[model samples]
Target: MSRVILVFYGSYRQDRQGIKLARWIVEALAARGDRAELVDAKAVDLPMLDRRHSDYREGEAPAAMAALADRIAAADGFVFVAGEYNGGLQPGLKNLVDHYLPQFAWRPAAVASYSAGPFAGIRAATAWRTTLGAMGMVVTSTPLSLARIGGAFDTAGLPAGEDGGRLIKAFPRFADDLCWWIDAAKAQRAAERPPF
Candidate 1:
C-alpha cells in the first residue's frame, strides 16, 4: 500500500536552494508509490510559536495551522529537508514544527539535510535528532546529507551530474529504511493502542 508521506521543507531565504532537494525527495517518494506532498514552510507562513493547535478552541486556530494539524495526523511518515544555518536547524523549520506536538507522535521521521558548503548540514540534521525524538517520532537511522547542494540538484529538481549520481544511488537505502519503519508503525498502530 502507498503510504501518505509529507516531505517538509523550511527555508525563508530569498533564493532558496534547499527547496530543490525537497522537490527531488517528493518526486522520488512518488516514484516509489508513496503519496508524498511538499509542505513548504514559506508557503505555509505560520507565525512564531505561540498557542499550539491543541491549545486553541476547536475552530479558533489559524486556518493553515488547523489544516496542517489534520494533515500531520493523517500522514503515516514524515521527512524533513533541512538546511544548515550556523551549524544549527533552520529557524523556519523549527518554528513550523513547534506549532504542534501530538500531531507528530508515534510516526516515523527521517532527515535529509543539505547546504551550499561542504558540511552538508550534518550538524543541523544531528541537532534535529533530539528535537524530533522529543516530538515523539521514531527517527530513521539512514540520513541524506548533501553538500554543495546546488551542484547536486538542478533547478528543475533533478539530480544533475556525478554528485547527483552518487546521491541517487544512496537514496534507495534511505527510502527503504523509512518505509520499513513506516510499515512497522502502521502494523503496530492497527494491532493495538499506543500507551500514552
Candidate 2:
C-alpha cells in the first residue's frame, strides 16, 4: 500500500484547528486503504539550522532533523495541515520544510490550512506551496481551507455545514492524485539503471 505522511504544523500541543484538520485528512486517507502517518511538528524537537560555515552538507544532522527527513523520505506523499501566523505559514512549518532539500524531490504533497479570520490560511498555503514546489514536490492543486475556523468548527471538531462537504470531497481526489504521482515517480526512478 502507498504511504502518505500527514504533517500537523502547529506549535500548539493541545487540540487545535490544524491538528483537527490533520486528523480528518489522515482518517480520510486511511479509509481509502492507504498507509497514513500523522506527524506532529510539536513532537519533533526542531531547532534552528546549525550548519557549519564550511560544511555545506548536512551529514550526520541532529537527530530531530534526521528524523524529520526520514519521515518525508519514507512516505510516497505528504499532506500538510498548517496554521497561519501573521498571514503566513507558521514558523514551525517553515522550520520543518527547511530541514530537507532534495529528499523531497518529486513526491506529491497536499495542503490544508485553517485560521480564525477570513483568509483561512490561504496566503499561508500559497507561501508553503511555493516553497515545496522549489523542492520539486508535486504540490496538489486543490488547497483546502476552513475559513473563520472559530465559527466554522465545533468543539467536537466537526465543520458547520455543507461547505465542509466540498472540502471533504476535494481530499480524496487529492489523495488519489498523490497516489498516482508517487507510483509514476517510483517507476521513473526505477527505470534509471544503477544496478551493480
Candidate 3:
C-alpha cells in the first residue's frame, strides 16, 4: 500500500537550505506514488517544552503542537531532513522532537542530513538515529547525507549532477527499507494493539 509520509525539516533561518532539500525529497517521494508533505519547523511555531503532565491533563495542548502531533500521528512514516550545527543536530529540531513523544511510536523514520561543509552532517544523522530510536521509531540504517549542500541543488531546488544521480540511485533502497519497516510496524500495531 502507498504510505503517507511527512518530510519534516529543521531549519529556522530566513534563508534556509534545508527547506530546499526537504521539498526535493517530498517531490521525489510523491513521484514514487507516496503521499508526502513537507513540514517546516518554523512554520509549526512550537514553543519550547515547559509544561508539566498536569498542564496537559488540564486541557488541550497549544494549537500548533496539537496540529503537529496530529500530522505526525497520521503519517505512516517520516523523513527528517536535518542540518548540521556545530557538528550536531540543530537545537530547533531537538526541541520539536522533545515537544511531542507518543506521536512517533511504532512508526518508521528515515533521516537525511546535509551540511555546507564536506562532512555531510553525518554526526547530526547519527544523533538523530539514537534519539528517534529511543523514541520508538524504526529509523532506517541507510541515511542520505549531503555534503556541501549549498551546491548540491540547481536553481529549481532539485539535486544537480552527481549529487542528483547519487540521491536518485540511493533513494529506492532507502524508501524500500523505510516502507518495509512501516508496513511491519503497522501490522504489528494492528495485531497487538499496544498502547503507544
Candidate 4:
C-alpha cells in the first residue's frame, strides 16, 4: 500500500509544544502504514515574499518556498500541527501556507493545535480551516488540541496525559478520511486524463 505523507506545519525547535505534537503524530502515522514527514517551518529558509514575484503563475518564489510547494504537490495528504499566537494563527505557518497555495488545492488536511490556554487552540484550528479552505483543501473534522502542552509530554518524548490517548484515537479516523478523499481524488484525476 502506498503511504500517505503527513506534513507537520510547525517550528522545529526541540522545546516547542507544536513540534512535540508533530513528532508524536508522525510516529503514530508511521505505525499505521503512512509515510509521515514534518515540514518544520523553523528550519525551512522561506524568505519574505517579494511583491514583484509572489504569484504562482508568473512569480519566482524563494527556493525554500518552492521546495515546500514541491513537497505538498507530492504528498497524498497533510497534517498541520500549529501553535496559537495571541489568539490567532502563527505567522510562520501563515507564511508557509501563503507561499504554497496553488499546490495545496484539493488535498486532504488535518489540523492539530497546542496551547497553554483553556480554548485548547481551537481558535487557531478555525483560522487554519479558513486558510486551507481558501486554498481548496478538504479539512478533516477529527481535530486535536493539546492544552497545557508543557505538562503533557514526558521525559521519554511521549504524550503523558489523556490528550495523548485522545490523539491516538483520533488519528485512525483522520487517516480513514484522508485515504478516502485521496483515493477518490486520484481516481477522478485519472479518469479525467485522456487516453492518447
Candidate 5:
C-alpha cells in the first residue's frame, strides 16, 4: 500500500522563495510513488496558537482545525519544509504544528530546509529536529538543504541549472531513509500495539 505523506510549508512572506523548495519536495516524493500532499501554512490560514485541536471537546473543534487533525492523524509520515528566520523555525509552520500533540506521535518526520543565504536554513533544521523529536516523531537522519532558494528551481519543483545535478543526486538517499523508517513503523504498528 502507498504511504500518505504530508509535506508542510509554513511561509507567509510577501515574496516567499521557500515555496519552491516545498514544491520540489512534494513533487519529488510523488515521483517516487508516495502520496505526497503540500500543506501550506498561508493557504491553510490557521489562526495563531490559542485553543489546540486536542483542547476542543468532541465535535467542538473548529471546522478547519478538525479537518487538519483528521489529515494529520491519517498521514503515515511528514516532511516539514522550513525557511530559516533568524536561525530558527518559521512562525507560520511552528504555529501550525504547535496546535497538535498526539496526532504527530509515532510517525516518521523529515526536514527539508532552505534559505536565500549560504547556510541553507541548517540552523532552523537543527532547531526543528529537537521540536519534532519532542513531539514524539522519529525524525529522519537525512535532511535536504537548498541554498540560494531563488535560483534552485521553477514552480514545478524541478531542479535548475548547476544546482540541478546536486539536488537530483541527493534526493534518492533522503527518500530512501524516510521510506525505510516508514516501512519499519508500519510493520511495528501492525505487529503490536504502541505503548502509551
Candidate 6:
C-alpha cells in the first residue's frame, strides 16, 4: 500500500545543504510510489516555544503551527533530515518538533543527517534517535548519514561516485526497513488504543 510519509528538514538559511538533501529523499520516495511531502522547517516559521499551560491544554497552538500539526498527524511515517550544529540538531528543527507531542506518538521515524565534516552528522542522528524515542516514536536504527556533504551530491542532488554508489545500494534497504515499521505501526495503532 502507498504510505504518506513526511520528509522534514531542519534548515532555515537559503544556502543550507540539508534542504537539497531533503528534496532528494522526497523525490526518491515519490519515485518508489510513496506519497511523500516535504516539510521545510524554515518555511513553517514557528516561533520559539513559549506557551502557557492553559494555551496548550486548550489546543491553542500558534496559527502558523496548526497546519504543521495537521500534516504530522496525517502522515504514516517521517524522515527527519538534519545537519549537525554544535554537536546537535539545529535549534529551528528542535523547536518545531517540540511544538507537537501527541502527533508523533506511535509513529515511525527515520533520520538522515549530513555534515561538512567527516563525521557525517552522526552526533545529530544519535540525538535525534533519543529525542524521537522520548516523543514515543519508533525510530529506525539504520540512519542515513552523509559526510562532507559538499562533495556528496551532484547538480541533480544525486550522490556522486563512490558516495553515490554506497548510498544507492543502501537506500533500498533503509527504505524497506522504514516502510515495514510504518506498516506495522499503523496496524498496531488501528488495533489498539493509543498510548497517549
lDDT of each: 0.92, 0.71, 0.84, 0.74, 0.89, 0.85
* Cα lDDT of model 1 by residue, 143-166, tens digit: 888889878876667898876887
lDDT of 4: 0.74
Which candidate, 4 or 6, has the higher TM-score?
6
lDDT of 1 at 178: 97
Best by TM-score: 1
Tens-digit lDDT track of model 6 for 95-125 = 8788788888899999988888888899999
* Model 6 spans with C-alpha error above 4 angstroms: 52-60, 193-196
Kindly indicate the candidate among 1 and 4 with the higher lDDT: 1
List runs of model 5 lying over 4 Å from the truth.
Answer: none
Clashes of 1: 0
Residue 20 of model 6, lDDT score: 71
lDDT of 2: 0.71
* Model 1: lowest-lDDT 10 consecutive positions: 154-163
Q: Candidate 6 overall Cα lDDT vs. reference?
A: 0.85
For candidate 1, the TM-score is: 0.97
Model 3 C-alpha lDDT per residue in residues 1-196, reported as the tens digit of each score: 7889999887888878878788988998898888999888788867776962225753477777777778888999999999999989888888777877778888999999988888889999999999998988889888788878887889988788776667778878888888888888888877987655
**How accurate locally is residue 49 in candidate 6, as Cα lDDT from 0 to 100?**
81
TM-score of 3: 0.93
> Which scores higher on TM-score, 2 or 4?
4
Model 4 ranges with Cα > 4 A deviation: 12-14, 51-61, 193-196
Provide the TM-score for each candidate, comma-separated. Answer: 0.97, 0.82, 0.93, 0.86, 0.96, 0.92
Which residue runs of candidate 3 sit more than 4 Å off their true CA positions?
A: 52-55, 193-196
In model 3, the clashing pairs are none
Pairs in clash, predicted candidate 4: none
- Give the clash count for each candidate: 0, 0, 0, 0, 0, 0
Quote the lDDT for 170 in model 1: 84
